[model samples]
Target: MLKGIPKIISPELMKVLLEMGHGDEIVLADGNFPAASCASRLIRCDGHGIIELLDAILKFFPLDTYSENPVSLMQVVEGDPATPTIWKDYRSAIKKYDQDFTSFEMVERFAFYERSKKAFAIVATGESALYANILLKKGVVVE
Candidate 1:
């Protein structure tokens, strides 16, 4: 055990966070996401929800201050009739760490998968909510 590290963060997840540099992005894929096919590097976080992982990751991960939007989400398809209430929860959790955080870049479903494929790594979570996928860009940690 390490002091200050969240118990929810696994060794593989921690190592991926350490390996990432500024500008690299990580995807926190929802349960329905095709993470195995999309990820260049995949970190299995089975049985954990994205919200808990998001809060825990935000403790050590810095959002790109240089980018206007350091976060991205999968956009709901047209006429889907599914209202994603989880987005509100995402905003709340992100704001807890980044006060200046405004909104997420909404990527069309297929575009999101394409973008995720190019990410430095993807953490596949067991979040059951629809459209719960989120992507976070890494930033420099200033002293």
Candidate 2:
């Protein structure tokens, strides 16, 4: 294992993340996601839930500062002002690393899927919760 690397990040996932350029998006999705057909590269994080996998990834990657919403989630069909439970957890996890970031946006389910289809890669987690999916835009490592 490499120093500072999360063990949950497999070699394949590591390679994909390293190869991705700034602004490239990656999907951390639940088991119900159609990852096999949508993913350009798929990493199987079986038995791990969304938050766990997201926490691991945030250790290495920073959210893109250039974008208005560097993180995006699939919105619940009936829109409401209250944040979705999954989004709440995601916010907390992300803030653990960078507290200044508080922006999050939601897209229609199908629109989110279309966006995921173009992602650099998709990490399929074993989370059973409905709408437990998030897309992260990779930021540049500014010197």
Candidate 3:
């Protein structure tokens, strides 16, 4: 085991993060997401929650400063009553890394799936929150 690596991040997930280039996106897929169908590369983080994974990932993974919305989330369906309170947790996590981080772009459900298909990789988590899937665009590490 490495000294600083978070326990939540598996070797596969670490490798995928290292392999990704600036502007490439990775998905933290919720339990309900069709991750297998949407992912080009998939990493299973079963029995884990996205909030913890998100916090761990942001510790090393830089957000795409070039993109207005480096983070993206699946929008709630028109008639769905489920409000994703988890988003507040996401913002809290992001703020820990980027003080200026304000919001995430909301993609329509189908559009989110299409975008996920193009992501460099997807990490499937066991988070049970509805519409909890998030896409994070990679950024360069500045010296």
- Tens-digit lDDT track for model 2 on 2-121? 888888888888888888899999999988889888887888889988897889888878889899888998887775554447777889999997787878878898999899889999
User: TM-score for each prediction?
Assistant: 0.98, 0.91, 0.98
Ranking by TM-score: 3, 1, 2
Greater-lDDT candidate between 1 and 2: 1
lDDT of 1: 0.95
Q: State how far residue 95 of model 2 sits from its true place (Å).
A: 0.7
Candidate 2 least-lDDT 10 residues: 76-85
Give the Å error, residue 136, model 3.
0.1
Colliding pairs, model 1: none
User: Would you list the clashing residue pairs of candidate 2?
Assistant: none
lDDT of 1 by residue, 1-143 (tens): 89999989999999999999999999999999999999989999999999999999998899999998899999999989888999999999999999999989999999999999999999999999999999999999996
Q: What is the C-alpha RMSD of each candidate to the true structure, in Å?
A: 0.6, 2.2, 0.6
